[model samples]
Target: MKKSPRRTFIRDTAIAATGFFIVPRHTLGRGFVAPSDKLNIAGIGVGGKAEVNLPFAWNNGSDNIAALCDVDDRMAVKARARWPKAPYYKDYRVLLEKEQKNIDAVIITTPDHMHAVQALAAMQLGKHVYLEKPLTHDIYEARTLTKAAEKYRVVTQMGNQGSSGDDTRLVETWIQSGVIGEVKKVHVWTNRPTWPQGVPVPKGSFNVPAELDWDLWLGTAPQRDYNPAFLPAIWRGWSDYGTGSLGDMGCHFIDVPYRALKLGYPVSVECNVGSVYTGFFQEAIYYESYPPSSITYIQFPARGEMPPVEMIWYDGGMKPPRPAELQPEEQMGELDGGIIFEGSTGKLMAGLFGRKPTLLPLSKMASATLPKSAFEFVENGSDGHQQQWVKACKKGYGAYTSSSFDKSG
Candidate 1:
């Protein structure tokens, strides 16, 4: 009888586990769970979103949580309490070196600036990586990581759960199958910067908190005295530490349209940021941070059979003009954000994550030519995205993932 690779590998792990070489539960504690099929995983940046992301990726203990690392002990409290047996460290470099033998994959939920460095470091050691969206802090780093993922021949996934959803694939089918003929323009908008921006860094005598490692938390970013202004979740508004609102939610917002249209690199891009007035004629010195609002235009060159495409991004509560085809009572998009693709025959609108996709005019759905999909495109939500990566990791390198560097980059 032929054995599937997954089952064969699990059998081997079970054999290895039952060997004379055994581990003491006392060392790893009662939390030590040795599931033969489980991948030994590490959690980097186990705070903020990582707090939530870890569970989704861990998938309720389907995978073993072997190690945990974070710069802030205060922020790490909940995670540490949850996985006490998983050794904790304040420094990723240290955790990588010490736990290198224990973990098979690394989940990176660090801030934008640290993403490239942490992910690159882990991948260099041949560990599979699950990194958050936007991929890296800059274009160069993003390109570098993309090449590294291929060169190292390791399984990788980007944390854009919307890409894994059924709505995303459905949108892809609708566009690819010509339901919306030749999209030439797209408008994406978000209501981000829910954190403060457009203001200069605050002034005060701030003390670095005892539970946090200020220097490590600011990895690759320029050094400054740690301040309360950037703590917990406010870093998204800062230019040095975070990617601002665009990087905060743009990846999720653009994933559907970009993939469906095959919109490659932009030919030309331009952007303008709104200014903040500091009373009188003076404007706030916010060059160090993104503005409260921004509008960007990206023009992509035509692909083989596709036409040149123009995509506009609006954030900070800005939105495009309401389509005339729709009645006044019809909703344009969710309060969070939405996207509209202007095609030759009609327009397609969807929520930020491609949810509730619809044809314009409310009446168009009646006559819209729905495409026949080869397979059902019904995947959606973050839980499925995390499990997708976990299962892919178990399947080894070259396994499929929805938003690997190839797609997300």
Candidate 2:
């Protein structure tokens, strides 16, 4: 008969992120009682990025850490120590099977390759999921998870915290409001590959680490011998195991233009990669890993009043040419990466996650009439993203999330 306290927090949280409210199911249809006021979340990969994600998802103990899962116990130390009582499992399937009734939701921060399987397994059990970004390994997996989330009618959100940021919605509003004119081109670049990339696979027969289940860690991916080089968050460059820098950061950098402009799918795409030559004119060919850098060109078709948008992605330190409109004192994006939008009237640019958005040439703002961001909800750090999902799950399905499976897919 009344709004749940969790639902009220979710509404206020949504107002911070999108200046909107998450209407509880009771208001729209039959009342739906959530699993609990405090969601019981299980982490599939409780290491690497999970170290940061788990705590944010926990949200100051408002939620319960019902269970934990990770192939490498070494990677699970902090999580296990934090929630010493939550059941831990090295295999996700076993975790799901054993703790299905206990966990109301799952936070899957596993690598890209394992996201689809781990997410679907839990969603099939009707558990809400907060999956890490680059939603799935590829298009097929993305589509599968997208369709499954809709079919199962579960709460879903990707790990792109920027989506809940004021800048994200600001960029969306600015572009959609035509302040940047009709965006015809977008350039996104990231300085990733901080790990071993463009190098030959490590060659050696090392005993599998006692802390890791080599076979379990390689779930759904091609079986391979375990090597220290592939982990500790260094798997992004491997073609077999990771999606390179693009996957590592594309979802964050490119997501702005894609959402702002509604670029559904690319019509055509081409890519070129930098070469690593062992000697002059002698290229060191390595097929197992992504090249040191790459340039990708994707062409998207026009929709409604919008024209065809040309999106270019550069990684491994490559970046688009500096816009002449930018003054000498100004910088394009931050050291990590940035995104630039080219429209008919002027250009719009922002650093990673579309933060610190600026119109080209510092002088433009004086004459330009900018629309108000209209966003009342603002989140600090990356807590808003996961908390949005937690609240959405508490409110039941149909609650709003910026990067749901359908949008991310």
Candidate 3:
């Protein structure tokens, strides 16, 4: 059979649109080339959480890591072992300057303070970015990144993996189904184990790691002496380097109820802590890092068709009061992190990102039926949330929730 020129043109157009190309078996074999095809990814911070997430991006099929950047040479060496072909750099700007054209997107898993600067630089160069959550160190940075992402029209995904979970959608469906009719209030809590919480500042000077480029690591943050306790995961407890427990887990823990209730921006935010201590460390540490503990209350106004919602955010050692409806056997196990949606009819409680949710008031749970208009839970079936972003990057599909631009600001 002979193919018409028009058919050949249409096929090629489809291939191009999909960022894929089919080559003859004899030439390049029988495989389709992805659009945004053959992405060369780079890692901005290759320690802590980035180590876990970077691999997922590679496993997603559309990306291949091309560069790794970290202020610590030890961490960079660890990353290099994973992708020996990818070059390493102490400063991300150097990597961006040298490999900007070679890289398709940059995964920024750096500290919250650095997220805005690094992400803005990447997006300015027309590269897509995947930023870790709580988006930025401050509200201003969050808004700035959102605007930059929009201006560049780049694909962006925030590191809130729970947003892409099947359970999350189920909770959304449950809410929309009126299983918990007209959610009026929500109490979200997490007992984030302390890594550096409540620990007073080191009174003595310490030796800095020779492998660490301390200046680069500090970046826009105020300069400080090296302290072993402040590095690695402990940084989350500090205000300068991190966002405390709420900033650390709030995005993930609170995301479900926020999304389920279609929460708009909070009208006001106030913090009530046990005590305030004055020192160089207090300025460096977030309120959640202190002992005796604290709680932040965020109130959001009802907008459009939604009712006003009161959200009580608890963390740095707090737990929700056990619901009265649960039997001894039905009591939730180890309330590490979860949300309870209190509605007029019944209550819906679920773990972070909607994992293993159970309706309260067992009678209501038994009597209530799935809504007729409810959408079937369709698993996207990609490896995970990061993979979903890579797939979206290749296919030009809009970002899923946990999206960088949409969720960050």
Candidate 4:
């Protein structure tokens, strides 16, 4: 593949960021050059979550944000302002083509459906990719992207930030130390309370914003009338653009237990969905949308060194029944999200989103001693997810959260 001019810029940025000694240009072997030098990065879908991660990418040592792309010009404006020197575009393809040589890696924070297409295109051109999670909208896309990453030999990282969290490491340690004993089942929940669940689609015709490119936003999804409800953040509840609440947070909430147990693809997945009918329909009343909630049951068969386990995911105002041993007062302070492990020896409860979990049945938890062999915490402080990607790209190091084609598929 003919490398683009952007490759030079990317190499320089990587070098500067890492303060690595640049190899003399005269010594460059036939085609090989040090991976680190400088890195030229591009941001896709510069709205919503993209806004949060874009700044981090820069902070992590991206020399220059070469391009900014988003369907909604309004959304891109903020990012453009932040990186005044970078060129901007409404379509990602145009950005990619124009900045082909000026860009080395692309950060995809687009809607779920567009992730695979845009990412695959970038990888085809040999650009490293840092994609937001669930990895892809559907299982197949996940599989395809994984294959592309391997084929291209491009550095890749999923947006599961928690995978790099200290709390997550703590959870892993606790499990490995036998603090939770043999886990047979786990329940995870998040307060995905958005619009009235179970409510019917709203009936209305509203003018689409001029700055918003509706068709591009729809992308591969079936076309539908413009609805403000789906825009911004509430789209997660809808089946089309977003992946219900489960897809939204599964990667984050379930990631800890998944890693601790070395979970693989689930054997079967069955959803106990709320009363939301199929077909293209918008919710009319907030309360009339989907039935205020649903629970998805995922069953995973035994993997190496791990036994089969049942995982229950709860969201949209639904919660698992409280353990009988806990007093009513003890449950009062519990937040809307968390995980509970039902082990053969005892039960353990953790705070929402993988906080260092505490043993349940307060009394027994206090008396129990954990095993000695466990990962010790070292203070490398700060959320280093973005930094990890930057270092990996510069050094050609493989990522810890790299999803496999088979597992994600």
Per-residue lDDT of 244 in model 3: 76
Candidate 4, lDDT over the whole model: 0.70
lDDT of 3 by residue, 1-409 (tens): 2222333433432342233112121222111125646767889998877877788888744479989999887776667887888988877867877886677778998888788888877776667788988799888888878877776667888888888777887788888777877888888887774666666665678888899877677776766777787787777777787877788788888888877788868999987755545765564333435443567778889867778888887776766677898787875524677888899888888887778777886566567676532434324522387777766665542544355576657
Ranked by lDDT, top first: 2, 1, 3, 4
Clash tally, candidates in order: 5, 4, 7, 37
List runs of model 1 lying over 4 Å from the truth: 1-36, 367-369, 372-381
lDDT of each: 0.80, 0.82, 0.72, 0.70
How many backbone overlaps does candidate 4 show? Answer: 37
Residue pairs clashing in model 1 are: 165-379, 165-380, 166-378, 166-379, 166-380
Model 1, position 144: C-alpha lDDT score: 79
Give the per-residue lDDT of model 2 (tens digit) for 1-409: 2222332433432333232112222333222335466888899999877888788889879888899999889889999999999998887867876787677789998878888877877777778889998798888889988887887678899998888788887888899999978999999999887877889989898999888887777766676788889886788788877888988898899888987898898899999999998888998979999889999999999989999999999988888999999878887788898999999988998988788888988688778888877555555634578888887888877788878998888
Query: Judged by TM-score relative to the true structure, which candidate is superior, 1 or 2?
Result: 2
Range of the 10 consecutive residues with the lowest summed lDDT in candidate 2: 17-26
Model 4: residues >4 Å from true position, as ranges? 1-36, 60-62, 196-201, 276-291, 332-334, 363-368, 371-382, 397-409
- Model 1 scores a C-alpha lDDT of 0.80
lDDT of 1 by residue, 238-276 (tens): 888788888889899998889889888899999988877
Worst 10 residues of 3 by lDDT: 23-32
lDDT winner, 1 or 4: 1
